[model samples]
Target chain A: MNLQLLAFMILSLVTLGAAFKVITARFITHAALYLALSFVGVAGLFLLLNADFLAAVQLLVYVGAITTMLIFAVMLSQVEEIRQGAAEEGFWRRILSARFGVIPLAVAAALAGVILYLYRFANWKAVPVAPDPNTTRSIGQAMFTTYLIPFEVASLVLLVAMIGAIVLTMKKEDRSR
Target chain B: MIPLFYVLVVSTLLFALGVYGALLSTNAIRILMSIEMILNAVNLNLVGFGRYITPSDPRGQIFAIFVMTVAAAEAAVGLAIILVIARRYGAAAIDRVRMLKG
Candidate 1:
């Protein structure tokens, strides 16, 4: 196999494995760390797909911001009781129980299978083409010109989200005053 | 150049895993994390198609950026809401928060 294929294989394995760990990790903090690792792997995959600017954004937004926020949430929240419950239940028993039973796995597997099966019939029209090297520049130009309205709307959404989060999480006394 | 088929396969599996996590996990934070994973899978598909099919137009990348922006906003709001639930109820698990259920 060529180097590109090899890289893809490694990155996918890392991404999938870390994602699985994020779901299964006993500690919520550990799960957050695993999520960060998974995000980094996705960033590498973005590089492989020639999304240079997106890879940077993935690393900065996902790995740097989101993961840290998740860890903080985990730390701030009282999740220890659930962790103890999982540990007492035992790993296999917890996963095999009716609450976390085979249904979810079956559903997920069926979804993947159906999508892949559908791919065989659909004409994707995917041609092998090398993407622009300076994707950052082109992406920037489009963001300001062709996608200017949507771009500003996204920023507005962010502002609203930030304010909403602050309002929702504010102390009772602060809110009243 | 890597084939788009393989990229699709990877993204499909990722999305499936995210679905499983979102469905199985009782923790509200875990569900949020699963949602992020789902968005990431979609972003991967967008960028992969952009690279393989429409290399000239950067629309896919631009769309992906918007997705990322919304994801960031979602994370912030979701986590804050979880924080409030946790503080009030002392647990962040979805099943535990049943105040809305009559």
Candidate 2:
């Protein structure tokens, strides 16, 4: 197997494992930590795919900013400690739900089959284009030039989100008393 | 012999798992984590296609960066909402926040 395949397989396994832990772990903090691990594995996969800029962004944005935000939210919400003996109560329901998860499995299988069929029969060729020397530069240029409108729109969306978050989190005087 | 198709297949499986987790989990934070997984799967597809098609242009990388930015923004807004919900309902489970249910 080539190095690329090896890296891809390892990262995929790590991502899947972390993702499983994220859902199954009862403690919210532990789940958030597992999510951080999954994000790191995803960053590694991005690196293997030669998306250096994206890999860095993934680590910085998702791992640094997003996960930290999640952890903060978890801490601030007063649910840091797992309730005593809560695990034993939900075991059967969890197990039963696992059986009911076959629907997504079947859908995934069908999608995979379709993707395989399309790619297998298609006569695709690599389009020759010069690789950019600096990906960050090219990305900046594209974002500021051809994709400027969308870029600005994203900024507007962020602004709206900021205002909305503040509005939602604000304490109403009537409720505070 | 593992073909590149297998890579795509595994990514799709991960995506599906993420979707199922997102839908089935009662915790709001776990749902966010599952959404991140789905985004990662899409990132894998983008980079894989870039590798198979044009290894030169880093457009895939650029797109992935955009996705990361959007994910960050999403996480921020989502966590804020969760925080407010927890304050109001005293619980963070999605099932508890059913004020919209008629």
Candidate 3:
């Protein structure tokens, strides 16, 4: 295996391990911390893919802003420490487990089927090389020019999300009192 | 020759794990984290395709960036909603906030 494959393997393991911890860990704060680690591993994977700008943004926005917000929310809610037996009491836990188990098997089967289908149509005569001089500038140019409409739509979505978050989080006053 | 098939396999496994985690986890925050993992799995596929097939255009990288941005926005809003739910219901378990369940 070459250096690229090695790096990919390492980063993939890191991401997958942390992701497991994020869900399996009982404590909310521990899950959030593990999620941050998973995001950092993803940033490393992005760097390996030569998306430097995106890697940086992943670290800054996800590991920094989002995880901090989650931690704060956990702390403020005083639910950082989960009480024992709480998980066992919920009937939804069993339902959720069954639902989750089936979906992963389905996803794995579908992905395998697609890969096999693509392999049947594979033409080995034409193999593409990796692009050289990968930079954020080229990406920005493409986004602004070819993908301008989608870019604008994404901005609109973000705007709407911001407004919705504010509306949802805002406290209602006791007008009747 | 390390076939690109392995990359796809790994990505698929990651995605499956993400889906399982997202669906099973009761805590709102863990669900959000699992969603992020799913998004990362998609990002891996995009970058892998970009590396092996489409070399001229950085479209996949651009799309991955867009994915990251959307993920960030989603985390922000989702966490805020969870906070609100916790405040109202005194807990962040998904089953407790079943007001929308018909």
Candidate with maximal DockQ:
1
| lDDT (C-alpha) at residue B51 in model 1 | 84
Model number with the top lDDT:
1
Top-down DockQ ranking:
1, 3, 2
Give the alpha carbon lDDT tens digit for every residue of B1-102 in model 3. Answer: 235566666677677667777766666777787888789888878876775667677878888878877987897789778877777777777876769632
Instruction: Find the 10 residues in a row with the least total lDDT in model 2 chain A.
Output: A80-89
TM-score for each model: 0.94, 0.82, 0.81
Clashing pairs in 1: none
Candidate 3 chain A, run of 10 with poorest lDDT: A80-89
Residue B68 shift from truth in candidate 3, angstroms: 2.0
- In Å, residue A105's CA in model 3 sits off its true spot by 6.7
- Please give, for residues B1-102, the per-residue lDDT of candidate 1 as tens digits: 677888999999899989998887777777888899999999999998888778888889999999999999999999898888877887777787888632
Winner by TM-score between candidate 3 and candidate 1: 1
Per-residue lDDT of A19-75 in model 1, one digit per residue for the tens? 998778776677788989999999999999888889999999999999998887676
Q: Which tens-of-lDDT digit does each residue in A1-177 have in candidate 2?
A: 487778778888998899888777767778788888988988887676556777888888888988887777776666432221123235236646545455545665576567667767877674554443566676688778877887787777778877777777777894577
- Regions more than 4 Å wrong, model 1: A82-91, A128-131
lDDT of 3 by residue, A1-177 (tens): 498788888887988788877766756677788888988888887777666877888899888988888777777665532322135344345545656556655765676568656755776443556546556788888999999998998898889888888877777783234
